[model samples]
Target chain A: MVNKFSIKNLDMYYGDFQALINVNMEILDKEITALIGPSGCGKSTFLRTLNRMNDLIEGVRVEGEILLDGENIYKDIDVTKLRTRIGMVFQKPNPFPMSVYDNVAYGPRAHGIKKKAELDEIVEKSLRRAAIWDEVKDRIKKNALSLSGGQQQRICIARALAVDPEVLLMDEPTSALDPISTLKVEDLAEELKKDITIIIVTHNMQQAARISDKTAFFLNGELIEFDETDIIFSVPKDKRTEDYITGRFG
Target chain B: MKKKINFKEGLIYGIIGVATLFTIGILVFILGFIFSKGLPHLDSHFLTSQFDSTSAYVDVKLSEGTENPLGLILGEMTLKEKGSIEKQVIVVKDIEKTSLAESAVNNKGQNLAISKNDIINRIEGENVEGKSVDEVNQILNSINADKVTLRITKQGGGIFPMLMTTLMMIGLALLFSVPIGVLAAIYLVEYAKPGRFVNLVRFATESLAGIPSIIYGLFGMILFVMTLNFGYSLLAGALTLSIILLPVIIRQTEESLKAVPDSYREASFGLGANKIYTISRVIIPTAMPGIVVAIILSIGRIVGESAALLLTAGTAAKIPSSLFESGSTLTVKAYTLAKEEANIELASAIGSVIIIIILILNALSKLLSRKITKI
Candidate 1:
């Protein structure tokens, strides 16, 4: 398997507070990697660092190297281009207050795709990939906010997919969803892993073990352990990881 | 179980209700008074004519030692001159024979008959011929004639020029203020860091809003009218009004921009869109309804503003041919009518018109906000 992202000695700080310490991980292409921890464990912060979404926040300082395909994302890449190559789905569904068609087409339109027919194709294909085309095809012109929460989340996924990014970062994308919607998003994520690498930060242990090929355990801004998902669940080398997975502590 | 009433809560509610009713009552009473006094006089003629009555003056000479020297009663009578042409001329309705000037010649060197119902188109040696009615009246009045009759032909009543000036002021003020104010607001809300300088700027804007509008008028008079030599023109008045409107526009626009969710910015940025694109497309469109409401309210302010315009826009009751020319808005015209001319009915009519304009603007803003939210 080819490595999609390589992080080396990464440390991140928000002013005086350190959110992520010296962490290192290699994310493989076309595989689902899950980061699991309790609340405020810096998993979400680490996920944001993949796409540099943390740059939007004030007083954030990052050090060390995060390489995408052997190119340093921080030093050698434009932030906009990097973001286009790596898309993010937030914890809550945030569809723009516009038509569903417009929400899906916003990314491509921003990137200078103007022709109606071409945009139509991209919108339909993206909605299909997000597994929401059939449900929203009839009401495509309606405002995206008018939809159910689960449907809105799916539309947001379609919006992210419209730009055709190589990597997808999901920060607790199912935390705001009900059980059925969570299952649908999980299935969609599994199906999407055949093409693009996905990095998901989830708190649910069963979810981390179920779909992810590789799992990384984090505690207090430090990476405790990283291994194959089955091995991490069955036999963890570190006592903290074993304790966290076996429900002794998080 | 029986529930007990809280005295404090009931007292607070009673106070609030009375205050609300008091406010509404004052507004209704004022509107009722203005409409009742003004609407009867607000006709098409009143809206379309000048504010002064049209008058024509004629000089008459009485022979010495004549009886009934002041008995020559004057009335407007149409007479047919050469070629069967009919024209409105001030003629003598009743004259004593002893007051006749047999050798009197008209200004045209033709023999004049001092009989009753004779046409008096000109006065001797005054050069009143071939001049406009206003000039002729002025000349006739300047002569100090002992026997002159002023004949009023038309009543001055219209507010057309004032209405136009008010509309133009609203347009020009918005033109000057909206772009600068909205841009300033965007910068403050989106780009400026929350620090000493930004806080100071916000404080300054708030202070500007609270300053009396008459002070703005004084400043505008010194800057635009005296220094710039605009000389009490519509442009000067509009510029002054623009300054008065700036703080309001900036504050409202900033509030609207701040109301836009940070999630929208995140979403747009995550899609590789630049800040300009994100703001123009996502943020501005969402905040448009609020901005529109702000503009409408600013227009209402412009319509009702009088003191600042009175100092800058001179009270010229005529249609301005250019921006440099003087003009009067509805409020300023009403002020002049009520204070200088003491024409209460016309002033009340102007006040009613201003009220109607503000009501329309309020309704329009509500409708627009609803439509935008629906979209």
Candidate 2:
């Protein structure tokens, strides 16, 4: 398998407080990698670093190299181009207060796709890939907020997919959803990893074990273990990882 | 537990109900008084004519032998004249038989025998010679056995010019202020760094909103009317009004912009959209309903404003031929009519018109906000 992202000696700080420290890992292409940890353990922070989303926060300092396809994202790639290649779905279901069609088309429209037919094709295909086309096709012209929470989340997923990014970053995307909706999103993620590399930060350990091919256990701003999902769940090398998976401690 | 009477709640509810009723009662009473006093005077003629009263007169004489000769002549003239002669009246100065016969040759040089009927027919026919009422009165009074004057008077005319000027001022003021206010708000909310400078700017904006409008009027008079040399004109007035409206627009726009969810911005940025694009497409559209409400309220303020406009836009009482031309808005006209002319009826009529405009604007803002919310 080809490596999609290579992180070497990454350290991030928010002013005086260090959020991520000396983390190193390789994310494989076309695979679901899950990062599991307790709250405030820097899992979400590490996910934001992939696309430089942390740069939006004031006084954020980073010292490291995060290589995407052998190009240094911080030093070489423009932020806009970098973000275009790496799309993020926030924890909350945030569909823009517009029509579902417009919500799906927002990414393509931003990237300068002016042709209506092309946008129509992309919106439809993205919605289909997110497993929501059948439910929302009739009401595509309606405001996205008018839909139920699960439907809205799926529309958000479709919106992220519309940009056709190579990597998808999901930050606890199903935490706000019900059981059925969570399963739907997990299935969609499983299907999406066939074509796009996905890095998901999930609080639910079962969710991490179920969907991820590779799992990385993080605790207190440090990555304790990184291995295949089955090995991490069945026989973790580190005591902390084993304790966390077995619910002995976070 | 036994069911107990909630006397405290009842007392509070009664007090609230009375207060609400008191407020509504005052409004209804004021509106009722204004409409009753003003509606009768608000006719098509009052709406369409000028603002001055004028009267015209013509004089004539009568023979002595005829019974009620003055009344007969007026009745005959009314029947023969093409226009309404009801407004015109004939005043007989004298009645004498000898002088009438001697000056029997009418002003038209037509000979008339010494008969009352001939004189009446001549007066009713084209024998009267004079263009203006004053000239006719002079000639008829000069060669008189009996002299009469035909007088016609028209009361105060309409407020058409004032209405036009008010509309134009509103358009111009909005044109001047909306863009600057909205852009300033965008800068404050979206672009400015959270530091002392931005906080200072915010503090200054809030203080500006609290300052009295009369101070703004004096400032506008000095700045736009004198320094800029726009003079006492609609352009000057609009410029002044725009300054007065700026703080309101900025505050409201800033509030609405701040109300936009950060998630929208995040979504837009995640799609690789630039800040400008995201603001223009997502933020502005989301805040538009609030902005529109602000604009509508500004329009209401413009409609009711008198003191500021009076200093900048002189009370010319005519339609402004250009932006630089002096004119009076509805509020200014009302103020002038009540203060200078003491025409309370007309002033009340103008007040009612202003109230109607504000009510319509209020309704429009509500409708628009509801519509935009649905979208």
Candidate 3:
């Protein structure tokens, strides 16, 4: 099976300070991969590399190959096309200043979906995939701001899904959400991995254990461990990973 | 025990306190005085028409005499000092002013007239009965018509045109300023790389704001009026006001755009939105109410401006048929009235309308700004 994305000897920088150092990872096709770490860890920075989201930040530079389906995305590939293939949801629930339906349609519209019926179907299907359709379907035309934090987060997830990306990258997607919303996203991630590859950066160890097929641990700008989820939790290869999961150190 | 505030701090605070109170006191006093002196003359004719010069010189004639025609059966007109009587007499015999040449001053300082037509004609109009234009002027020289007693009627200063002029100028000014300034701000905030050039733009905008409005006026008068050949027209005033408002729009819009979290921009980009699309669809909309507020403040500033409009927009008090037509706005009208020492009541009424317009604009801005967070 072809790996959806593979990073080889990647390093990243923000001006003089190094954020990720000599990192290598392969995200398997249609698999749920969880990146677990403490605060200031390079996990989120590493996740941003897959879709080249870090390009938006000023003073950011990345090194080495980020091959998505065998093509180095950092090379001659169109960045816009690259981003369209890999969707992202952020930590905070940032719905656009529009109706909930329009928020979902934002991505599809950007990729050029103008027919109303197509957008409507995409919005419904995507929202259902994100597990927010039943709650928001009645009032999709209302402002997305009127929704609660959890609903908004799910709406953001639905918005990302509407673009039909093959890969979904979540950078601490549940950090700003409440416990119930976090569980809901975890469950949604589980179901989504059947059709699309998902790489989630998370601080919560239990969520990593419950939803992931593979686990990668990062600390101080380095990939500390990468292994099967159960073994990594039960028998981590690195002392740092063991220490972190056991709460002896972070 | 804790010591009380030091004498120096107390003195500093006391000075600030006194200054605040002094400002409040002055505003209260001004408002009271304006409301008192100007309020009584706020009538419908004053609200509806231009100050009639004919109101200044009334003609009274007695039918029994060969001369007096407004039928001066009663002539002495008076009000509490702010009002006085203007008189002229045209003598009509066989329905023609037979003794029109006899209109002159009596020994008692009151105007004695054989005919009102001769007196009325000298002050303003033509068509005096049986008198040549020169003969009418000679009679006016000898008449006891007191120019001092000529009260320009408060009913004459119409608020409609000046009010319309102020609105149109402000509307055009906003139309010119807001789009360009706001787009510039969006570029600076979202797309531009930070460097010496951006710094220069920032400095230039700030400096432009600090440039006196009169300088803007002079530039407009010279450039748009003379060089561009627009003349002292609405377009000239609007363009001048737009320049004056540019810095304000840029600064306010920049601040408001900056207030939107970087995360939103990142999210938009992460969703594969182009820079232009993100700015136009998301950032600008989020920053819209703030831009509107900046526009409203610009409106108030432009409406209250006189010196700027005086040089750029001529004080031609007539209905402007087109953008190129010479026009006088409310501020210009108030200024001309005050300068000529013409009707204060009329001028005060114009000032009151300006205030009302500013208040309405502020309320509208407040209303418009409420949608940003919800948008």
Candidate 1 lDDT score at position A106: 96
Model 3 root-mean-square deviation: 9.5
Model 2, span B80-151: residue lDDT tens: 233534423232233354344423343445543232212122243334422334544444445445654333
Residue A153, model 3, lDDT: 88
The segments of candidate 1 whose C-alpha lies over 4 angstroms from its true place after superposition are: A246-250, B1-21, B48-155, B366-375
TM-score of candidate 2 versus the correct structure, residues matched by position: 0.81
lDDT winner: 1
Ranking by lDDT: 1, 2, 3
Model 2: per-residue Cα lDDT over A1-250, one tens digit each = 9999999999999999999999999999999999998889999999999999888888999999999999999999999888889999999999999999999999889888999999999999999999999999999999999998889999998999999999999999999999999999999999999899999999999999999999999999999899999999999999999888889876
Q: Which one is best on TM-score?
A: 3
How do the residues B1-375 of candidate 3 rate in per-residue lDDT, one tens digit apiece? 234557778889999999999999998887776667677867765665554322334333223433433222222222222356433333222224442323434334556433321123223343444454356445444554422111112223466667667778888899999889988998888878999889999999999999988999999999999999999999999999999999999998998899787777877888888887788778877887888788888988888888889998888776577999877888899888878868676677677767777779888987877765544
Of candidate 3 chain B, the 10-residue stretch with the lowest lDDT total is: B146-155
Model 2 Cα displacement at B331 (Å)?
Answer: 1.3
Q: B296 in model 2: Cα distance from truth in Å?
A: 0.8
- Candidate 3, B144: how far from true, in Å? 40
Q: What is the TM-score of chain A in candidate 1?
A: 0.98
